[model samples]
Target: MYRGRRRVSPAVALLLASLGVLSGCTNAPPPPVVESTSSTPTSEPPTEPPKPKVVVAGIDELRGGFNPHVLADQSPVTDALSEIMLPSVFVPGEDGERVLNSTLMESAEVLEDTDEFTVRYRIRTGASWSDGPPIAAEDFVYLWEQLRRQPGVINPVGYRLISDVESRQGGKTVRVTFEKPYPGWKSLFDHLLPAHLLKDAPGGWSDTLDYGYPASGGPFAIRAFDLDRGEVVLMRNERYWGPPAESDRIVLRAADRSENLNALRSGNVQLGMFTADASTMEALRGLGEDIQLTTMPRPVTSTLLLRPNSPQLSDVRVRRAVLAALDRQALVEAGTGGGPAANLPAHAQVLAPSQPGYVPTEPSGEFADGPDPERVARLLTEAGYEHSGGKWIRDGAPLNLVIAAQFRETSYEAVANSVADQLNAQDISTTVVTPKGDELYRTMLATDPGVQDPPRSAGIDLAVAARPVSADSAATMAAQWGCPAVDPDTGRTSEFNMAGFCDQLLQPTIEAAVTGEVPFRRASERVEPTLWSGAVALPLYQEAQVLAVSREVSGVRDGAGFAGPFSSVGEWVGAPGESYDW
Candidate 1:
């Protein structure tokens, strides 16, 4: 069975705000500093307050699972770890609208194209890995070459986006070319491994067991990892190339929500990360006035993937019937208590709101204010299905559905169970399958095509996956879907379309969004209709991560969750502050 990592509580967030302690960190301007009119007339300028010393801890710790070259479950652990290392590229921005961070390379640009493509990067002079080794262009060259030769290496997303790479002989830069115009190529820069560190990675780069332990070049390095004790401690990297981190040491201690909350109250851990279960949130009020909390929605969407290829699901009529049957509003309310800001099911595609080409689509069925069983029954009837012996049937078979649920997603499981009940009420038989974590990725996501449909290797029928895109660049369509390759000569397609869906209308629009040479606005107009109007995938609730710190911490600003758990790691500071009781 899969275990769940801790999640920050929203009720607690609301409660904290009610108490007027440091609450949610929003981008809103700080409540205007009230002016002391007469007293401030004296000629002295106001002095700034000292930075606060912030200590942050969470239930999840860095597991040294930071290598992006290999396939692994993405989580706050990996997200936090990525900031310290340099990708050949990085997505820099909020709400999945990230851009390339030029940590090691000064600039990168496309240099050549063919069925095979090539782009070049100019490395920043004097850039060195945390180990003090000079970074060379051949590092990426070697990295890509290894990826190409490895068979079990299933990072098709990167492979689909990148065609090939070449290390410039007698040069200070590296060039990579793609089979097609992969709009999301910029993500490669987010983290690039230092080739010198893992040149002999065992079983080749495809062997995750060997490749997993490769070197890191971030601001911190793994000091210790004790899984049985459930603690991973990280220490400052003295060889860091960027501005130094304020804390000399960072301890990642794993604990449950109750333990995390207790640790916070006792000051055993300066920060606590826990899911905002009802009890945890309610108890935060008693955690004292010195605690600070902030939360932001994650770049993820929970969804139900309908296998259109299934004998019972392929009909547009059936797809429409299923949509009509689900009470998404009720599902969100039951799962989150406070429904999403909008009643609309969360969009399934990974495009962020800030993405230049993002378009909002309407739900496909009778998306009303609430669930209506009569309306659901009516849709089923219109689809040529009839109620017989108190069950909906088509082609002499009962309408039965088996939904695969990933383990440890308690909220999602609740939602799935509720959905099954609703469908059964509508005379449809539905079953929920809860699978273990590894099996979920391999069977559900990799093979089933339901969790990650048309499957990343094949095409996905439907899936509810999280995808973050770069907001800085004009190209914002998620690489997972829009980056599908087209044969240069035959003009045929590659099986990378996550939806396994290709509409004449959507195909042209997706192509324009990815390969169009026009401005962002034009591309958005073309792409928006498909996303917002077609409602190919439903958008559900946005997720969030919360940070709680001691009053001593300062310079902590509001940021997206994925950038890092301590996203403001580069800016956090600590100084003397009033005692906890005071």
Candidate 2:
């Protein structure tokens, strides 16, 4: 320390001493200094700011089900990816009501509620997919055509009510005529895929969006997705029509509970949204005040779906008998245990019990509380089944049922075992088959085996699967029960009916209720009794989605319904600090 001043280098000091001696010797004749002028300043150059880090978000699993609309292709990573990359007609506003996204639409309004309810949608001229195609009616038609009958879709109710979709303005504008007024129409076409890319490619639904969305219309687009490395990266879409996203990039990393927690503590991941146990939740709590943890109800319910298309279970009486034979309370207990799902016992068929305005649409006394053995027996007898040698039989073949459950889901496996045991006790020969999720949802549950002349014996008649139920009450009702209308012109039948059963009689009422023709409550009142009597679904519980975000990232909040934390991805940015390694 040189007298509270920065010490000068020895070389500079020597140079200074030499200059002083030379100036002293030539005191009279000091040469006029010639100035060499340059435009550049003599000061040191300014240092550039450090580049921002890629926002790493930890997710439970990268199951790679990136198609948010399809139930089978639903996971946290998928939901997050879809929310940021997919286009929507109406985004959830501050009040959670459907508001038009100015970027995607020029105008969307009801043309008239005439004989056939008509609505018009005009796409913004500049709106185009990340790939190449312009965002147009073709995309809308593709989704409606695929969702209406292709099966495994989330919200197809409003699409089912559409009698026709006519494209105008060189395919930029769409005129839709619904069979009735659809109040939840805004919920349709939230995640529109590129029609030119996926409409005709084989495995149109499941295989296309397996890794990531082929095209993005929103502010971000998928850059790279690697399941082996457990990461899906999204970069800013340079071609996005609206205001650019504030963040440079978003990376979703697949991780287990412990690893996810570790990443959060180590700051390897700034935000995390994953499924967590009590211990994991506690671990998150221990991460101190900086971590923001939230628990939201996932739009999924564990359900025992009885498909009526099986020749053995074709009769409505037989389907109801199957419901009567099983003890639902035991099934729920076996599946949920003491998990988060245990708390939200699903009571209604359309709207999950956790949803707002959820009244137990479970009819008064069709064994609303428990199994009814007498009801099972009477229904079997009425359906022409004869009880002989402790087994129900028709045409000398025993009443054997094949139940399919996805092997990947532990809770569902337990639920399936419970269902099998309950049915077996009632003298029903039941065989529980554990199929891969793809086979279970895409093929077994999706295909109507009974469509063949002699019903296919190899396929499953019942499925224990996760049914995603959204807060859109009308959409849920129609998606679950709205009969896939037979188009007399095209002659295409419903392919992926979640429940193989179809009720033509109740379909119109369902249509009326789903479309704004009948109020949701009144429609549910008129629909639930007959719907429950059909005994199609045995909903166990609503699954809860968990999110843990650190203070390092900002602008996280719940969206309208199933949008999750990723809804605000456009506004999310990494906190300024040291550069990140990842």
Candidate 3:
């Protein structure tokens, strides 16, 4: 994600003020300073109070107690907060390169052995949690144990490969040994919980840590979390080893896109991050000089995931025909408000266009940017499908497919509608189903056990979803396509495979990538063709990450993917000449 600032037009500034503007002055000029005549002829002018703590909106909800390890509660907001309040040994830079965060770790190195790989991290001196517990190797061990034992933790695939962890140097050094060479080892340990807090819980860490974590080690700590009001307040961590946070308090309020926009226009929030559709950007520009827009290439790809084993989609020809029937460019244009530079049509599913080692692959056949009716008809016919009365038929039944997507994200809903419309127009009977809350989770992972059965049985054939690829493309690709891991004790399969897709042909490439046996570019190139051949996921486009900040809010940095905007919160400064009291 690139970080560049663009100023709003003067006309837009006037419009924003008329809509609902926050006053330029936050503290009413401090009553003109009162001259201080009674203070025995004060020798020096009073120091200006700090500006009001910056308020930011656009957080969807405070879930999983702001813990990254908690799978169910992980959201954009929580991910952002985790980066601010947890220990991150390495952080992804604006260009998707890894940068060391020296406040958390003094140094990190990878040592290769004959049979295993060893990664060591040395804790920074005087690194302690807000509650007085010094950060130690035990925290890393606790994190690994919790993630290994609990399958519900998100992104546990890499941690599962770690055979053991050893602590040395008076508990200041942590050594992680992997069974084999893991290329993505640098991407781990971004969020580490304090082991002392939950080490003695009777229940598993996942169940016992549902509530929000109250202590923190990073630049900020949680001060209050009012779930009823959907608001969270974070104060600067006094014990932080690095430079203190710029703002005295950072307030995050849960609001929808529309609410967040209104909050921005009204000055209730100083910074807001959302999808900068053309209209939204235009609106912000029209609101005038108060707003500043920053644009970055989103690391997420909007995708249409097809069920692997569904009888209807089992045929490669049918899948290819379905892909050929939709116009990907049109879908992207509509989703990004016709801003060509804002989004790009995605051809590869494993790595986004902006990521390193990404090579663009062309779509198979003549389906590149098309609603190719002739090609669709020809493929369908070759696959034993017949068109009668403007509806496709196969095996004496109408060719009906259900498209599933979550209703919570507006972009997915729009993409799903567009895809469904395109298919329906091409003689395919299509139904768009949007589920929310528990139903939405079940719909997304329906193929997994206890998720209301496979959605294919419910006539759902396609799903519009968004998948985030990490800077370490190897680990991400492996997690998505590698064989599922089965627990020896429980005889249950891990839920890491969302599409229930397993191809022996692709597994070797994935394995090579995961184990650093092959170069990332070579492995990615090798796997891309096979993924396209299977037609498991049709990538629509790479969404752009957009954030609107007030003119007074400076030092805001853009983060990679779901890391959000708080990666450099220590440098964030509010309005000038005002001191923040609360």
Which candidate wins on TM-score? 2
Comparing 1 and 2 by TM-score, which wins? 2
What lDDT score is found at residue 205 in candidate 1?
A: 44
lDDT per residue (tens digit) for residues 1-582 in model 1? 123445659998788677665444555566778767675555545465543333445664334344544333445555555554554455446654554556656777866544555677776666667677767766776666554333222333444445556666444577777756665566554456667756774543433422133445666665666666666556666776767777645556777777788877877677655446445556665687888865544454555555454445666666666666777777665555442322323543545443344455443443766556777677678878888899898779887776655566666677678778777877788767766434554444433222433432322233433333443233334233343445443555543333334455545555555544554566555665555433345556655455677665666665652454455555655443322211
TM-score of 1: 0.72
Q: Model 2: what TM-score?
A: 0.82
* C-alpha lDDT of residue 302 in model 3: 71
Residue 461 displacement (Å), model 1: 8.1
Pairwise lDDT winner, candidates 1 and 2: 2
Candidate 2's clash total is 2
Where model 2 places Cα greater than 4 Å from the true spot, the runs are 1-49, 112-116, 163-167, 179-181, 200-206, 314-330, 363-399, 421-428, 447-458, 470-472, 576-582
lDDT (tens digit, per residue) of candidate 2 on 155-262: 766777788999999999999988767677777778778888888888777688887888888888878878898887787898889888877788888878788889
Root-mean-square deviation of Cα positions for candidate 3 versus the true structure, in angstroms? 13.3
lDDT of 2 at 465: 78
